[model samples]
Target: MDFPVLWCVLAFVAINMIGIYDVVHLKDLLPPLSMINAIAAAYLLDKYKLPNGLVALGIGVIFFPSMTAPIANLKILLGSAEPPIIYGKAPYVNPPEGDRKALGRWIKEHTSITDMVLVHSFGTQVQVYSERLSPTIYFNITQTPIAKARFYHDLRQNKPAMILIPMFPEYQNLVDADLRSFVSDLVKSNYHLESIMYNYQVFRINK
Candidate 1:
């Protein structure tokens, strides 16, 4: 009867309906319920003496996540799972957002054309608006060491006038250890906390 394909199609249809209902009504995915549905689908197939196809389909629904969940649970028990890195291109900032808009305005008010600003990451917004030079716009996985070295070199050579710490909620507490350490050192050495407005920290270099 090709019941597997039929069951799969039915499952997909059910999933789509739930998704549409969530968007139009709940506005939340209700992920736990989704997981419950997947498990229940498999259990019902087995209990009903349905073809092995449906049971297999049900198992397949949650299989990959079932495998990974144990590892995720272990990591949570031990500590947090490693923070994920976000990537971006230079001179192409995301459209000025809530805090980002405030930051852009502040940079324009204070920084000058020839000034150099050190941004933790996501430099494009300030760089474009301030017309100030930045060491790098975004962190890269492949060139972590190179990025670190270049930042050190920039500190020693260019000696940026100000360092901007824009507080992106996702990355506020999730920066790489090396990058965090570097920023801590800079703050201790020459940078002074000028202001913290709208989730942005402005650090001006000591004269």
Candidate 2:
């Protein structure tokens, strides 16, 4: 097998191990994850024609975790009356929750921090909505993907002034807190917090 294909297979086995491990250890959490994985597997299976069965299985394993990571994320659609907060691959902007205009204004006002922008999953929003700001972008949700190496890059070099989260929900405060904590861990804390609304909260990073 080619190196890329072999690496994909290994990734699949590792992910399947994670799911199996989750099933064995955290049985309660496995069902939702399993359901999400099943959906992704069945969908992707139909879309991609993999000649090798083992390769297909590997792809399934690798893809399942991202599909099922959020247990209650699906509720926004089935339980809601209005439009969902996520559609297709793009995240749904909850009305009054995450105003693109507000984000743009924030970015426009902080033009000097253009190089410091790092939106986690919705990092694209900054580039999409903030027309006034020409950002160097140390990390973006769509364009830039990384692990821990981006830490010093964002803090030391880029000096990101804020984080733009797009799929920010209305009810899941605890999950939101955890997500914020994860984002905050990446930056230098310039201020305590600039603002916190219902859908999104803006943090004023320490320069």
Candidate 3:
């Protein structure tokens, strides 16, 4: 076997081992197994004997997204900067803009230090800017069966004061039916729509 392909195979096994450990221990995968997998795939593609054109195409596919920041920076230097498009494979030209800081400030003013908030999408930003406790930190409900159950359990146990659902331009929030049903049921039973911010909805738990 080609050395890089062999390396990729070894890396794949190592990553799976770590992943299994994380699942068994109810722990988050450190450094993200996806990143490790991506690196391994890149190495394999780089070393695998293939048509010159195909190799070039594969490398370009990997290289382009990583260049977004540099390209944006160059645009800034030339005084032609567009609204800072975020970096990723399916790049959006200019996403719908909203003042999250203002929303955070509002949350801070309305909620107490002890109040736990649940935020989807921009959980870290809300946590940092709002300075409130959030049970949803680094936890994604759709990732695994354990995570999904854990999310519901935490919601039941903590009864967080607020839940924020931001409207994405791509409407990713609407994709998961299971999660949507859970949120809808929770809203119907224990929460009410408190306010709608520029690009998000805040729901308050009934006291």
Candidate 4:
């Protein structure tokens, strides 16, 4: 065995010592032996048979996080790979959680006698707040800019009592010069800056 093979074996032994056995039940001895054998094969083949990238990838696969591993396994295991890059994995936020009542009073005080309608990006979750306020909410597509334009144009011509800006990613192109100016002028003159919610701006247009 070469230096790399010896190093991987040492790492594996260390992993077992550090309590990585909770993950995938390391006690049977077969998996560790299999891993050692793979490393040995990789070492011997590194010279003449196996490609360098393949050997390195094999080592990474053995050393990295197993998807089936228990949650705290990383704390106990050595050389654990970082969590994978999975798309659509939404980031988390921690809050005191849903035991407050002042927000109810705030919404009631703001939307009094106004037929408010909230516009948001689809699936951004403004609808939850709109329930008690009796305001309608419209949503735009997350991908196409053209869809956003059609939405903005519709909103301007209809002139809803209120508008909610969610600051979503897909609408940047639609928030161009004309759109910005129109919304800005409305906010300054007739629209009142109601409140901010989860990075969004709520504005009430006084008709």
Candidate 5:
């Protein structure tokens, strides 16, 4: 009963279970799983006295399929691919439907520096690009009831010049249904759609 092997198996099972439950991103598990693979490989090599080249080849065979997308992406980045390859129902370098950078530039040009904006994306990409303040620090306000309340309060108090709502499928899961309904109603009542970036809807406060 090899303790190290048993421990590695337990760790692998636990990490996969956590990932299965949607507690963490699958990408986050890569590091630990890679470490486990290294340990297992070391053990196998010592036990079987396997040639180094054979072990390397075996590892490459096991992981090459997973590397295909990344390899394609590398080629795209290097300007070697002309049109880019489609893999797993998506293009290798598929940019999101909208140009976020262009949207940010539009915000920066049209809105006053003093104006605050409300964005519902995951990061500060909009803020950084727009050079405008966001009413609330929490980007994904639908994550908690308190955050939602704070966002509502901020929305009323700040009267932001624009509210950017993501329209992409990937963002659909991040938004709460109730919050979405509230925002839709609010936008209908108090805001007008100013611009439609393919991935986002920009609404301006009605004058």
Candidate 6:
């Protein structure tokens, strides 16, 4: 066996073992596996002197199952079928509609460009849509003690024009206990609730 092919097999096995213990998605494995498959196929063909028809049939049998989704997507692109409503990371689907979108638009229209916004427990969609800056680039600040301290310091120093907090069901459970308490107390003393969107609370800094 070729050294490069042997290395690829070993790497593939190692990655598979790691995946067994951790969350590894199929998409992450496709690239490396595809290269390995190609190299192995080339080696087999060179060694066996396989007939062209047999090689084509083998390739079709091996790859037909994986071609279904891509073919369907191609059909959709060619306007043969209506696209599905996919949420989260699908470029074809419409932008999500809800309190997040409303709040984003409100912030963009109401606040000045220079004003920073602090979003708690919610992702960076609001800041992205509003085209406003955030005190911290990270959306989740309660991951570690150091991260929490950095976020708190930045929050105090920046003094954002508004704070967005999720009010959806069980949203608070996602946040850290100490961080939640600190933010609640700070908001009560320094900020006031300006408006309540369907699933979010917007707080503006006190004058």
Q: Which candidate comes out best when scored by TM-score?
A: 5
Q: Which residue segments of model 2 deviate by more than 4 Å?
A: 1-98, 110-115, 132-138, 142-148, 165-182, 186-188
TM-score sort, best first: 5, 6, 3, 1, 2, 4
lDDT of 5 by residue, 67-165 (tens): 777987798789896553333242123233134566677789989999888776553566678888887755444455666777777666666778877
Predicted candidate 1 versus true structure: per-residue lDDT over 1-207, tens digit per residue: 354445555655665553323232342334444555767776877788788776677667856455576887799689886553332332222333434565666776787777777666545555565656665433211125665676666666666788766555534444566776777787779889888644556788898
Q: Give one clash count per candidate, in the order shown.
A: 0, 4, 0, 0, 0, 0
Better of 5 and 6 by lDDT: 6
Clashing pairs in 6: none
Clash pairs (backbone) in predicted model 1: none
Write the residue-wise lDDT of candidate 4 on 1-207 in tens digits: 765456557766765554323343344455556677766686799667878788778879878966665754564476565553332233311111131133233444566544555544332233344434322223423223554466566656666566655444534544455655655665677678777644346787765
Per-prediction TM-score to the true structure, in the order listed:
0.47, 0.38, 0.56, 0.36, 0.63, 0.56
- Write candidate 6's Cα lDDT for 1-207 as tens digits: 765566656766765643322233344556666777777788988899978689989889877777777987798789996543443332322234444576678889978999888777744566677788887755544455667777788777777888877665445656777877877887998999988654457899999
Query: Relative to the true structure, how large is the alpha-carbon lDDT of every model?
Result: 0.59, 0.49, 0.63, 0.51, 0.67, 0.69
**Candidate 4, TM-score vs. the true structure?**
0.36
Best by lDDT: 6
Model 1 spans > 4 angstroms off: 1-98, 136-143, 167-169, 172-174
The local distance difference test score of model 3 is 0.63
Better of 2 and 3 by lDDT: 3
At residue 162, what lDDT does model 2 achieve?
A: 65
Residue 139 CA displacement from its true place in model 5, Å: 1.3
Task: Please report, as a residue range, the 10-residue window in candidate 4 with the lowest summed lDDT.
Answer: 92-101
Residue-wise lDDT of candidate 2 within 1-207, one digit each (tens)?
654455555655655543323233454444555656666667776789645587677877876765552544566556744463333233434544255566666666765643445545434454555553322343432221342345434445554556554444532432335444655565334544566422455565665
Pairs clashing in candidate 2? Answer: 85-92, 116-160, 190-205, 190-206
Query: After superposing candidate 5, which stretches have Cα over 4 Å from the reference?
Result: 1-28, 65-98, 121-124, 141-157, 171-174
Work out candidate 1's RMSD over C-alphas.
15.4
